[model samples]
Target: MVKVVQPAYGRVFQDDEGAAELAKVLWKETVAALKEAEAVTLANLARADRYVRAKVEFENLYPTAYQQGPVLKGEEGGEYFNYRWSACEKLNERMLKLEKAMFGEATVKAGREKPAAGKVAADEFLGPDNGIRQ
Candidate 1:
């Protein structure tokens, strides 16, 4: 189940509008949460990319025993960094696919006319897979 975070402005809201107002509040909260998650995921991908590039450079320049195989136990630099690099790469791939689904070019029928690059129509997401109005 998805969870929505408390809105930063929630304290200013009143309870007079009852259920309808509450529903709107919840929807707003959900949108904010989604935006926050997107930002964090993007930032994480950037950090992971930097770490992987640096790891490759370090290995090339030093060519230490830990860099090759059977990294030394309790080592904090090479082995640990490599593990982090692998985990982050996996996460980055998943997030990028999701990002593509959200903001990048969505798949259309091969024979259909394609929209201008970066031009997503309003009704594009109004399908069974996505709840956005297509």
Candidate 2:
């Protein structure tokens, strides 16, 4: 049998057919809902989109120093702060999931990976007697 290796696409691989089947089915219902009643999903998408837009807008508009209310004092004038997102954590959790589902699904981005464990470093010599400095 051929040996499988580490960092395959930087993610875990399904070792057997049953694991593969489970992975495929995990999102099957969500996809089916999108197909069967697309409008419902679209509405959720729309709400999520609006919230994201508002968030970005707030970031742009109210970029004042943290706890340094809008009217800045003399020393705090130069620095700016990001919008605080701690007030409604439950809403944040719900919207974050909805937003993640809308954005990061079925997409893959290339990334740099370190050399696998068995590979030798370029600086190392190949022999049992090769001394390693402490």
Candidate topping TM-score: 2
TM-score of 2: 0.27
User: What overall lDDT goes with each candidate model?
Assistant: 0.44, 0.43
Tens digits of per-residue lDDT for model 1, 1-134: 33333333233334333433453444454355446656334443443333333333333334343354333345444433445445445545654554454345556768978888755675466555445454
TM-score of each: 0.23, 0.27
Candidate with top lDDT is 1
Residue 47 error for model 1, in Å? 21
Tell me the lDDT of model 2 at 112: 80
**Once superposed on the true structure, which residue ranges of model 2 sit more than 4 Å away at CA?**
1-45, 49-87, 105-111, 122-134
Candidate 2 positional error at 1, Å: 48
